[model samples]
Target chain A: MSGKGGVGKSTVTACLADGLTRLGVSTGVLDADLNGPCMARMMGVKDHKPSSQNGAMIAARNAYGVPVMSMDMFLPEDETPLVWEAPSQQGAYTWRSMVEMSALRELLSDTDWGDLDVLLIDLPPGAERFQNLADLLPDLTGAVVVSTASQTAMTVVSRSISMALNIAEVEVVGLVENMSTMVCPECGYKDRVFIGVETVEELARRHGVPYLGAIPFNVGLADFLETGRSYIEMHAEHPAAHAILEVAQRVHFWLKNQSK
Target chain B: MALKSTHGPFDGSMSIVYECPTCSMQTAMLTNRAETQMVRSLGVKIGGRTAPEEPMETLRSNLASGQEVSPERPAPSTGGKCPFTGMVNDAIGAAESEPEKPVWTEGALARIEAIPGYIQPMVKRNVENFALEHGCFEIDEDVMDAVRGRLGI
Candidate 1:
């Protein structure tokens, strides 16, 4: 999954893994958001530590049995801060970037994802890091681009989609418009709260990528995340979750088509 | 001569395991980029994940059946240098699998470890070569004496 930061990519990813596994697909979720990783905690595997073989880490499986791997799992403690400030010495940043990218590649290629039907990668935001991941995995089936329905988010989202389509040479599986509306918990009324004037469907049309669907801005999403429960698991009837399941089905279909 | 292929403790890092052929000494290399890249690109599997086998899988299996698995044969020389090991000219570059580690007596490996890494491989190679020439795999104190006598040292 690729998107701007805070655009609900992690939630979308978690729901997809849950839905896919429920649908009988052996699924794995790779948290590639090194700078801001949240998938482990969001998947309720925050305390799950990986087992080691060779030098590579085996991802810890959550209660849902979805194998989850994140760079943060290797960190000493949950509260330990990650500060990657550029050094003052010449070529230090270049060296650091190379090492960082190498680490990223190792995470992707080294993980023993055995017989996974689908591996949903929760990528860090921006085209550069996405491009780095693209370079690392040549066999990626495609990407799911998440965007909030705002002109500002669309501009960055479109650029990233183009990078994936044109430069990365990976398919843009579809576009998911997250936080498209706010659902009133008491009355069940849907309000188009934060999508600005335009919708992601229009953006997807312009980009020529398939428009998967839209997710409602549910306040309970935050609460569910805080309590380490996936929205799909606890609130399957929630509109946002329903939309995410629809997106997952589309992805499954797309993957099937690619196989054929 | 049971062969042992054990990796550096599992840490999600690319592990380099040195499989000892005769005495069965297992040394892990923490795998350099070339080693890791080779395995991943070839899709070389890990524990309990090996199936729908690929070319490298066969290579590894055949490699286990007394065939040499030279993960070092095609090592990409980084601009006439090795950036992974951070070494420069005349240094014996770190190798993933070198098959021919001339047997060292109890204190010999420790002594070789004391040598600077930049020159240790060269020293090891030279000593191994000396042993091979004399058909002596075990380089104990007596073999060292023979080598010293031969080198006029």
Candidate 2:
């Protein structure tokens, strides 16, 4: 999934993996966001360490037995920050990008994923990394873009979609609107969180991609984040979980049609 | 070719004349030590040695007489060992000495073929690696099932 930062790309990735697994599809996730990797924690494999076998790193499994590989697994502690060793910090910018690319390459190639039907790579924000990933995985199936209802996120996410369709020349599976609306937990009332210039459905129509679905901003999801719980698993009947599962179903049908 | 003035000599700059081994096309450029080191670091070999330093009068006279004068410092010997070449040789040697990839039985190949083309490569590679790790020289349906069992899928 590719999108602007804070648009819930990681959250959507976790939910999709969970939903896909529940649908009986073998799915895995590669947390490509090196700087801000939260998949390990979100997938409830934060404390698991990846073991090496025959020069390939074994992926960590979540509670559902879904393999996950992320830079967060290599971190020593939650508070420990990721830092690259360099000769000097004066001009680290020039080489830091290359180092990050190399790290991503190693993660993709040197990990023993053990055969997965779907490997959802959770890309960090920005269109550049999408281009890098496209270059790395030539046969990339497609990209799923996530965006919030805010105009700022829409503006940035539109550019990302353009980069995927125009520059990367890959198919955009669909667009999923995250936090499209907020539901009042007290009274069960729905309201728009951001009064934007355009709705996500209009943006998807403009780009000519499928509008997967919209996930409501649920307080339960936020609490699950703090508790390291799978919201989709626990609250499968909730509107937010139902929307995400529908998106996953659409993606599965799309993949089935694509394979044919 | 004409000698182009690039950077100053104080920064370890020197005039280099490169003669192509194939076409004998001579090219001249003024480059500094920093640039040479940078190029060498990228695994490119720079030809020609630097000429010894001479008096300004002698240099001027040599230029006037159309006599080629070398730069102040000699370029390192092209015969010297290149770290890049050594690295490439080591990689090639490692590959040559490595064990052969395990063979996939017809049944196993058919099972892999049943997978989608996009993910077939990954699935095949993972299964083969798994087979190798388990000391299996031939991958069949049993090996495939074992991989699934190991992954608990």
Candidate 3:
């Protein structure tokens, strides 16, 4: 998952993980936010630290039933505002991003991922300096582009997709439009909050990529999300959960068929 | 991202980060410490040198923030004007002619040798300053010639 910062990348990633779990597929989520990770916070398990086993660190499972590890989990709860210089920051990047990527590879290779169907990699928002994962690991499966309906986000998303395709040579599986519409929980009236903006479907169509459909904005989902509860399990009838499940099913089908 | 500094990589020794904002194209110091620090910090494999634009005002502000000022001296107008830039290099030359500061030992000489070719000149200049302040030693003429050639002085 990739896009510019603050564009619902983590939310979509959470939904995807939740969807995969609902389908009875054991999924492992790796939060590759090297410098400053927020996945642990999003998963509401920032305090749950992982322990070391032999030379390697064991992955921490969140309350939401996803195996996750991130720099935030290791740091203090109030350490968010601390400014880290390049050197100290490098230690985190090496341990959290690069080494974590290596650990994921070893997990897939050495460990018996019994009955595991998919591994979801939750990447950072922007494709900045530390976003060279494809170069570091050549065995990266194709990625899904997460974007909002904003014009600037669409531009960055386009560049990110193009970059993954051309430079990284990773296939662009699809584009998921997050926060497409906000519906009133009381009246059930849907309002195009981000009206007149190009959705991910439009972006995919323009770039000759597959449009993976849109996710509705819901506050109940947000509350569940903030409280680290599984949205699909809590609100099975929610529009956002259904949309994400459909996308996840399509992704699973595509990946499975490609293996054949 | 521990920097795997083998010999083959650019090592940022020969590659200098030049701030060519003005016509003079002033050179910025890409010290071994700075280069390795940046590489580790960024954590990406930089095949070659990459130049980022820096403003003079920003640099000056940084110097001021550290309570350090450029040594106050006129540039060496050996002729009436600077033969190179024609703007006064006199500021730097004048500072050079003043009483030498106490020398640090050749403690960092071996370290400098590990650096790439292009940056050797600055290290040589530092060594020359140290030697002159302590006591000048005559050894190899070829090395002196190479230093002069590289520095174009």
Candidate 4:
């Protein structure tokens, strides 16, 4: 999944992986966002460290048995930031991207992902990073773009979809609109959060891709995020969880058709 | 393999020796303006060498100054044009020329027409481009299937 930062790419990835696993599909996740690695926490495997066996790193498994690999697994502590060792502090900016790419390549190649049905990679923000991943993973199936209903998020996400279609020459599986609506906790009322803008369904139509579904803004989602809880498993009846599972079902159908 | 740097006497350019780990073969490369220009044109840096400006900016400056830039291969000979230079020019000319549209067979046209109207144009363009890339000027059902297999769509 690719999108701008703070648009809940990691959250969506976690929920999608969980949802797919619930449907009896073996899935795995790789948090490619090195700078802001959070899938380890989001997948409910933050306490587990990857173990190396036979020169291959064994990924940590979540409650649903979905293997997850992320930079967060390698960090010594939660607050510590990821820093690369360089020969000198001068002019480090130029080669930092190369280092990050090398790190991602190592993570992908060295990890022992044992025959997963789908390995969802939670990508960081920016079209350039997506391009980098396209180069790294030549056999990439497709990209699932996530965006908020706001114009700013949609504008950036549209560029990502274009890059995937035109430059990367990859298929865009579909678009997922997150934070589309909010359910009032005080009174059980659902209302649109962002008003007077082009809807995500229109954006999907404009790009000729499927509008998978919209995830609601749940007030309890913040607590779930903080505690690394499986929101879908915890609150299956919640509107947000139902929306995510529905999107997962559509994605699963798309995958089944492609395999045929 | 260890890398050793030496300072040039006249131009102040740095020369670095790279040793191959497998064969222990040593090669020296001079970090000069031409080398920097070549690296920048390729949108990458070697070792610790950094581009002072954006790659496109450097390429534009080189083009504006009439300096030949060939990132993939060396600049073709200008004073005494070689056969390779002629071939390169021909390829560049072909690329610059209008792209030849591939002819769609009845079967392929029917298959594409069966697609949903909203995505028909996209699928058609993608298939045609795939056909062209594969040197299939006449697109048929086989070509369409090949495109589908290549894209796994």
By DockQ thresholds, what CAPRI class is model 3? incorrect
- Using Cα atoms, each model's DockQ against the true complex is 0.02, 0.01, 0.02, 0.01
Clashes of each: 8, 3, 6, 0
lDDT of 4 at A117: 94
Off by over 4 Å in 3: A81-116, A129-131, B1-31, B35-153
Residue-level lDDT of model 2, residues A1-260, one tens digit each, is 55688989988898898888888889998999977889888887887765667657778887778888888876555654455432122344554565566667666777788878999999998889899999989999999999998999999999999999999999999999999898887898889988877999999999999999999887667547434456777886899989988999999999888989
Off by over 4 Å in 4: A225-229, B1-153
Q: Per-residue lDDT for A2-58 in model 4, tens only?
A: 557778888788878877887888999998988788888887788876466765777
Candidate 1 lDDT at B100 equals 52
Model 2 regions lying over 4 Å from their true place: A225-229, B1-153
Runs of candidate 1 exceeding 4 Å displacement: A1-3, A54-56, A83-91, A222-230, B1-153
lDDT tens readout by residue for model 1, A16-96: 787777677799988887657788887777776555465445677777677888766654456443332111122333344
Tens-digit per-residue lDDT, B9-119, candidate 3: 121222233444445454533334344434423332223213331212121111111112331222234434323222212322333445344333443455456565444
CA lDDT of each candidate?
Answer: 0.63, 0.70, 0.56, 0.70
- Per-model TM-score, in order, reads 0.61, 0.65, 0.58, 0.64
- Check candidate 1 and list the clashing pairs: A52-B10, A53-B10, A55-B13, A56-B12, A57-B12, B16-B29, B16-B30, B18-B27
lDDT tens digits by residue: candidate 3, A70-176: 55544344433322222123234343343344433443333222345677777777674224667666877778788888788888888888888777888877888
- If you superpose only chain B onto the true chain B, what TM-score does each candidate give? 0.32, 0.37, 0.23, 0.37
Better of 1 and 4 by lDDT: 4
